[model samples]
Target: MKNLALFDLDHTLLPIDSDYEWGQFLVRIGAVDPVEFKRSNDAFFAQYQAGTLDPVEYLEFALGTLARFPRPQLDAMHAQFMREVIEPALLPQARKLLQDHLDAGDLVCIITATNRFVTAPIAKALGVEHLIAAVPEEDEHGNLTGKLLGSPTSGPGKVTHTHAWLEQIGTPLDGFGRSHFYSDSHNDIPLLSVVTHPVATNPNAALSAHATSLGWPLLQLFND
Candidate 1:
């Protein structure tokens, strides 16, 4: 009998949203030209939230943002960003909560809409054992080919991916016996519905309403 814990990144584990903050950070660090960066970033984000952008195109465009930097430089930048920016974004309580789960020996996994290449390091940093994230298609030469291996992980896609992972682990959908999921957006409703304990963390309006209606617990992390 195992207890499974599925965590949402961005607003759930961290107090801030990663995608928006990453764009702003790139501008500040001169990684991108401010105006053009913001314009492209905003548009892509809009399309992503609306579920219109294909995973491949989205990942290629995002990776292209790092085109000027070689892998080594980008890796160093990612490390710095995680230490100075991402680390600060985590709430003290949330950190402690995750630690408690780890101490209890539960299987903790991150289920996010973010692409695997971008998030794999962060997931490693967080000490999470597993990650179920959007996977970009790759070419034989190991370049990003701008395609998706599967549907983007969001809405119902979250549940779909999660169930498959569970099956792979030889754990049925309900195998956890006691399971918990934490997320911040209404967009996660499909995934929320499948969990035994669904927590709304700094939810958006729709999720807040749904949580209230379902009598699910709501948690607020940081003020901003």
Candidate 2:
């Protein structure tokens, strides 16, 4: 069986938070109100870093922004985000690590708490085929519905979601010869614990402490 490799998107593979950056991108482009939108965005991000994030509440705000625009406009804006914001943050070491996994014929997947709408293209750009992320609902007309369709992939849900995704793909979690999860946040500890090899990739202070205590490998993909 192929070895399973799971990577957290924000702060693990990339140095910045993609979801938060996307919000700031919108604000910078005048697509969102500068004051109130930014205030709420910063507030939610603070909660996330503090490990007290309410995924549902953040999702409501994030998805609602998507719901306000047509798919075409969102796509255009995201394309700009990729060029202006994400492109700069992409590190050679991160790309190399992903490529090494692919070369080893591992089942590489980016499992993130960010909604699929925001993270899908980023995953595609990184050349990863499979992605497990928060699901956003769409209307029959192909417009965003401003609602979450399934369990949020944060905290403990990451473990369950990974299991479900693996099962759906005909591979049980225990079936792998070796499974690995790389993450930066303590919120992903549940998933990290379940994997055979838990790597702290550019970990935050909390995760750094936890991983250090567990003797998990620390991987710093960026110089800074």
Candidate 3:
């Protein structure tokens, strides 16, 4: 009986990408060495913005970076980063919009390509009801194994997870007469195409072109 409001996290809800922010935070906190990992991170991010990066390859690269630190350290670093860096990056208007959806009793979800480890806390902080994100696997001893548990939630994979989440909650695709999806990347084309209302928020160049061609509404909350 409830409508769905699915949002892509990176560049959509927050002004910047969550994963990259986490990585940079790790560097600043000494969990990761910036001098050593900067090149890989920069290259990976460049490809990500261009929308040509392979999710699996990027995950492999990022997860491998986690091998340098223990789970306990990673956890502590994540908590610190969430408090200091991630939370501050959220736009005030974006938070208000999320609250408005919650006030209206809509089911809110974050459908992102970022892994669950890096995104779950942020989603919980925002009081999101559901999250569909790539998750890394862990070893029996509770250490990250540098492997993804399933398909990365990007492109077509996003559509699959969004539908699966809806089905799990018994919300038929057509049940929500006026469903909505907000994203900032063309990578979300598959998921955005299915929703009745598609909004492009702080869209990148490629997404802007696609949004223009489709006549979807565009919103830029921050000048930068």
The numbered model that scores best in TM-score is: 2
What lDDT does candidate 2 reach at residue 52? 92
Question: Scored by CA lDDT, what does every candidate get?
Answer: 0.80, 0.93, 0.85
Stretches of candidate 3 exceeding 4 Å from the true structure: none
Best by lDDT: 2
| Order of candidate numbers by lDDT, starting with the best | 2, 3, 1
List the candidate numbers ranked by TM-score, top first: 2, 3, 1
Pairwise TM-score winner, candidates 1 and 3: 3
Pairwise lDDT winner, candidates 1 and 2: 2
User: For every model shown, what is its TM-score relative to the native structure?
Assistant: 0.86, 0.98, 0.94
Alpha-carbon deviation at 172 in model 3, angstroms: 2.9
Give lDDT tens digits, candidate 2, residues 1-224: 78989999999999999999999999999999999999999999999999998999999999999999998898899899999999898888899999999999999999999999989989999999999999999988778999999889988999989999998999999999999999999999999999999999999999999999999999877854
**Each model's number of backbone clashes?**
0, 0, 0
Tell me the lDDT of candidate 2: 0.93
**Model 1 regions lying over 4 Å from their true place:** 46-57, 66-69, 138-146
